[model samples]
Target: MEPSNKINFSRRSFLKTSALASGGMLIGFNLFNACKQDVKMPVDLSTLNYNDFNAFIKISPEGKVTIFAPNPEIGQGVKTSMPMLIAEELDVLWDDVYVVQAPLDTENYTRQLAGGSQSLRLAWEPLRQTGATAKQMLVNAAAAKWGVNASECKAKQGVITNANGETLGYGDVVLEAAQLEVPENVTLKKPEDFTIIGQGTANVDIDEIITGKPLFGLDYKEEGMLYASVLRPPAFGQVLDTFDASEAKAMPGVVDVITIGDKAKAYLESEKPNWTAQLSKSKKVVVLAKTTWDAFKGKKAIRATWKEESALESTEFHNEKLNEILEGSKFNTRRKDGDVKKAFAQADKVLERTYEAPFLPHNTLEPMNFFADVNDEKVRLVGPVQTPEDAAKTVAALLGRNIEDITVEMTRMGGGFGRRLYGDFVYEAAEISDKIKKPIKMVSSREDDMTTGVYRPSTKYKIAASIKNGKVTGYHLKEACINGNMYGLIPNFFPAAAIENYQVDTANYKSNITTGAWRAPYTNFLASAEQSFFDELAEELGVDRVQLHMDLLENVKNNPDPKIEYSPDRLQGVLKLVVEKANWGKTAEGTYQGLAVYYCHNTHVAEVADIEMNNGVPTVKKVTCAVDCGIVVNPLGALNQIKGGVLDGIGHAMYSDFVFDNGVPQSNNFNSYQLIRMGQTPKVDVHFVKNNIAPTGLGEPTLPPVGGAVANAIYKATGQRLTKQPYMNNLQAKKVVG
Candidate 1:
């Protein structure tokens, strides 16, 4: 049967109920910000209508259950952990649940972007309830069938057994269970009764990944499907003066050539500052061909002129400007109750320093790619994307059809690192199908994937503290937030944090550059700056940085302020654990190490990085992390996330970043962009703290501290302070500054 070029909303809306969604937690968002929509139902799930039942359950007549998680896995191992939540209450063997990736429908989806470590933090409660409630519903149906009270039934694995020795599989009760009214509120399972949650389990997808299943978008294929490639700008904002599709389009297997980019009908009001019509602004030549090589040939032969434009101001320029401004100490941005000025004025010693970092890319293993099938009737998209609802809405709007007419199928992403969350790349695929009037697969080359992608905004942090009697009398942090609008990335914008007297003054030096999230986003910079500065100050006062943080934390705890409301329990937990676990202050002969702790993505992680120099190059030999996410779903998966974050941070510390000159990046591919390799892989040991509380997230919170840890370790090993990253070139500057 041929699918209509048009997607039916009936099927999209039908897949709404919660079930085992490919064993991973997923998040979903529509493309446009102003679009408001009612909940929709899809007509088919696995080619059958499945989602109209509720937010989290689909029971088969034969007893199998499907879960619909709203967030992307992105190799963080949600494919195993998130499912453990529902499986705990469902009382089913994990194998009994069939996991399918949720279709893109926002109403039933959670915050679909899998960043900020909120995957388990946000999904833990809802998913657990979904499981328990579904079980209770099934029990209610079974009770009615057996003429027994629901309390007489007990669910174990996939069967319901009564005290009378009668038993029936879930398949026997699901049809009747669906007809029963869902109770107003179903009592969830207690921890004591949980067999799956709070217990160690291996990742469900490990076998799949090892076997090389075609779960990722790059692995997706279709018969007679044409491949497409795009030629991007030389640098950001380097516009195409002219180009011809004639010669390249005639190449072997080349089907069509299309120019793709963001076409803003009008500059409507948006909080997003630093917005520019850039060469990197989603514009490209879509190369359509019969094979990947054919697409490559057409892409290689394309010729275009890159327009000269004013690039972003130099990092040095902004660094100096921010330093000068902070020296004036004009910060009222957010302050706690303190006479910090008077304290600083009376102090016998005053110290301050400026820290800065350049923009960096999230070079995920799997580059950006998406497949969209659009005909005159309906639109369907499949790829490894963090955003499905967003992609669907984009295709619908671009196709001039209703949002309900688009279908988005999310495939497993190789890695997110906060890059795949941007739905812009998905729009690239939809635009090609709409233009070429045929189903097409769009793939970005490694070059296009890196240089053309958005990045973590480079930032400069200035901090000062006044010391008296070996104690900090006054402290303030003035951060020059480069882009004025990284605030729009919030998923639920609730909760509060600690820290005060901090002014994040943003200035836009909008160049032809594009920017997006990378890991913890701004928190990575903030953690390195704030935590590293604390370490420096501790050394100045002849105190341990870990001890100093504990002291400050004590003060914060006693006076709990609203401006910066971090998890009090977590803050204290990681600090103590790291110190104890790493055998802090223990002798290691001549080895010097540094420590840092940070809480983000609902999880708190503290790392101790042991460092030693090998031929003047900083080498990290060991990393000890104390992670607390409440409970363990898949210990191995959680460990993998922590290890990945550390390696990623190591890359950022020693060999990641674009060398910009005259508005163009000197380094564009992996050869120039240094990522961590196996030779440098440190011994990473992760220990999750024992707690009965809910599990948070483990993806990104573990990253921020690795930089500070290494920086501190370098200082210990060489009686030198290294303030900058890519430890080679900046070593000179850091030594001079010290």
Candidate 2:
């Protein structure tokens, strides 16, 4: 069932209601005196009393239920799906619900970040209980009006029906309901009885997004707001030395040029260092102008020189360091089981392979931007930030102001993909506003975003397996990455418990390059490496690849470990389902297929890639994916995420490449960088496992296994092992010579 996207009120009506609500004279009701005899309810629908049911909900006199979505919507459809959980349990019609993005309210919402894909998983129970409690309160109010037991009256679709068949709208009893003591416990609906959840619902902000309305950070503006273009060090390991901004200040529409970072540098050097200092650049040249284009133009006219603080590193340097770390004896043992030495000694064959991937930028469609209005009185920050609370706290600390004096408003993001998780752009906006003591909108060009962005750490993995008498015996996996390793995050994932003689080691070489989470984080590349290695191991063992995975899963299921991070039953469920749906071994002429299954972000996913040769090049034609994320919420949004992750994974593994030459990024724009074009995207068929379990995560789980599936398929098509990422580069180098 598809929920309607049509809104009941017109745009003008919404604006009027918003204007009136902002004035505090309308849509406001005293919770304590809601049932007072002297209190009067307004008649106008625009001015109707909207009693706050809880932090997440507000009910109006007209029965219009407004559900507040606390998490920032980074195109993951949380704005639509999270509210569905509330509406489903509240016994309210989906059409009668209006969703709003809630401000940062620490008193009510916790974990208000958009990264880690834990938004829904963490809020699942609490949000449902919140709705159920409100519904029970309304039922109790209706029962009091009828002089009957609360159990005799039931609420459904905003209406309460008594045993005598008499009905009353929820609005009729909302005042009295507000006066009743909050219920401690309320019954939640069974998954089987859900009418709103498990159904596809259109995005709540789809209209605003498609109509070119102000939704994203780039579209935000305020009165007397100046546009800011900030110039920082052009390369890593470099700091600001000197700059001449006279030419920039003379540019048309240019307002002024200001230097920042002195205060930040001082704060960082103090005895008590602030964590926000690491988020923003320590030195910058800001050009303020009346328009965005003018600001950018003025920034280009500035002449700046940088001083290197350390040796400038390159891709070659990173590769050498990673390889050196992998070969070294000193390493951190993440996980170890039985004696790997004994298992290897008894093995008949020992096979090893090394896989490598380069650093990658998040490349969110919207370049980093934010709006800040900071002053001694209060600070108002508005932008697309995944962590609004963190951003607010950071700004407050930098400005030496009370956190309560700051307010953060979240705007819909064009894309996050873990990029917006860092509020550097937000910090820049706030610092510029505070320095100039004026409101300003900080903007970053595509080049600035690409060159100076938090990137996915480049990593190399060396995996080895021992086979004794045609059976897998021992496994040793070593990971070497930039800045950090995956030792802490996923030590208990698959393959850890499957092999008795399993051991995992990790090492890192801290570079000047900044790195952080990208989409699924470590599992993004680790899954591809592990899955591909398993495929090669299957070949050496003379067994089917699918059977090999099933066998490993059986081992994990039989000998369950207390620290196991994923469910064996759930992983097997997706693998079996995908095998059936993709016709595991069946393929048409000239079509080759490969399969991969992985668990991450508290979800299990299996994907099969179908590859066909197109003019001497193998191209992905279609992908069949099976997911078990527990109960599916908003199948439309779920399908979108599945397809998007698959395509994104394939694109990056096949074509995306980011390189640094002496600490300076070589690709500053799309001309040098490559992304999967429309012609390169494959057809993705998604199937979800039917279950009543609560939802887990959908934003990033489907991405981790896609690269492995594509690589395995390419091996079948071309008889070549693609070990390095940006597979197209390797494929081109190995092209048949005429």
Candidate 3:
């Protein structure tokens, strides 16, 4: 695992840190930026007055302020919204504040990741305190200059004004403020007095993104960086048998063909349970060349043979197994309140139905790619990694290098629904660079990203409900899914404790078609199945759909369980808001409505889809969504996430599915996969509940409810109960009679 090349200390140090002491107000969590501690700061440490700010704030003498956003920005708007939180409490003008994506520095910023919609939730308190501390420091500086009490000075929009009307801008005081001691305690602004948080501020990166600036990982480049294309096993559960790269080596611009064996086992075994690394394991041959096109051409020129394992199973096999398990498997009880069998026997009526969701690919707009420069001394990795710390761990372990020697820098990702969470691509680039003794940039083509990537496992849900005295008194859910060992966090789902007699059970079937996190994970399938069944139960009882949901929520509210994770009040809050906004009871001309609600990631979201059949095809005309994610960080960003999640869910429900045959994915690209197009997207109306609660994540909570909403709406439009995914497939199988 040792690198062949030796490194020089002076040159390596320059690449590690940023330019820290260029004569300005430099504030950061870490002391080392562009040089080692042996090199003293350009300014005197005493004159520079450094207080203990957690991380990420720098003010130039000329009034330019930069705040480094700690988390990765995978189209979640953290880069813009997080900085707004800092600038808002600091009382700085929006125009003067600039944002930068912070490099991976675990010592300074903890949990610097983008997943589970938790970036804002975890950083809210510390970031607010950081900004408030800076503001207090500036005020203290001004008070010392004027020889007045700090309380007498009022600060707003980067300026402090005294009782006598003497004003000093933050820029003017920053140099002197840098010399003042940071306050031990500072009060944050009340919600009623906020200016930047609730307001609809546009994303700061919009101009750069629109103008085609080099921000994404695919756009990254460096001097002497060689391009690489990895050739993966043709199918899942297959291994590399042999490869003849002699033809590829002779090609123009081709440098080397290196094979990366399974280096993930050691890293995964060291951890308790690392499903991300487990799913990301792959056996591949990397073709290195001068350019991406050359690498691609070289990969095409090479011929590799793969050996298919006998245990490999296909999608059809999995579907059959799921059916078998659902029909006869003894389900392990995850959550149970009452005897399901006894409750069903005593009920006036019983309704049972099965729902299925196929395996799905992330299909990120930018395929997996990473750049790595490694030697015996240091390992430098730069790419679109959602989990930087995890990626660094894998790289360090694989290369047998010190963790400190590894530096992971994140670039803006084109899209990572949840795909980039696995640092497999980062490791692959590092491994290739180490073996080849050169800097490498590994890229996965659209085909490689789609076919070889970890997919959202196929799932089956068998739900039964019992109606006694005109009310659903009992509920049972039996889930059988694939890749249960990998991403089985939530065993029991919402409404489990809502009913008087509720029983939840699950059974997992193992599969080799790697599955990891996909948006809201299991809720993506569970919400559709649970809500659809609830909708059917409502119909059987002759109750309005929305009213039925409200009644169940009320049941939970009246007889609350101590173990209930979601608040019935919050659930009802969003359901009522969505119904009111979507005109639930009224049907528009040529349109039918459907309702769905679910809670996940400590956020409650309800959505209603308005649909109309266009030439035998169900078309979503409009959608109304109501969210209760506590406080809104940026209204514009939250709304965008809500709208995007709805559209993404609708697209997946209506069209997306990945089918495998003989251990190979049948759908290779967009042509066969069928993604929801922009023209087919429905008009969406978003609303958020006003509350004093701290902010939660909005990126994923809005997606889970969408499938159920659309399915329920389709049932209203066509009177056909579609139980399988890609609802269009079921709709197409039968023509609606005129």
Indicate which candidate wins on lDDT.
Answer: 2
Of candidate 3, the 10-residue stretch with the lowest lDDT total is 1-10
The C-alpha stretches of model 2 lying farther than 4 A from their native spots are 1-54, 267-282, 485-489, 732-738
Q: For every candidate structure, what is the RMSD over all alpha carbons to the true structure, in angstroms?
A: 7.1, 6.4, 7.4
Q: Scored by Cα lDDT, where does model 2 land?
A: 0.82
Task: Give TM per candidate.
Answer: 0.87, 0.92, 0.92
lDDT of 1 by residue, 291-395 (tens): 877998898888776665445445565455555555655443543335557767888887887777778878888988889887878788889876665556555
lDDT of every predicted structure (CA atoms): 0.67, 0.82, 0.79
Order of the predicted models by lDDT, top scorer first: 2, 3, 1
lDDT of 2 by residue, 409-432 (tens): 889999999888777888889989
Off by over 4 Å in 1: 1-55, 244-247, 262-283, 309-339, 488-508, 733-738
- Please report how far candidate 1 places residue 660 from its true position, in Å: 1.4
Model 3 Cα shift for residue 665 (angstroms): 0.6
User: Which pairs of residues collide in candidate 3?
Assistant: 17-33, 18-33
Q: Predict model 3's lDDT versus the native.
A: 0.79
Rate residue 82 of model 1 by lDDT. 77
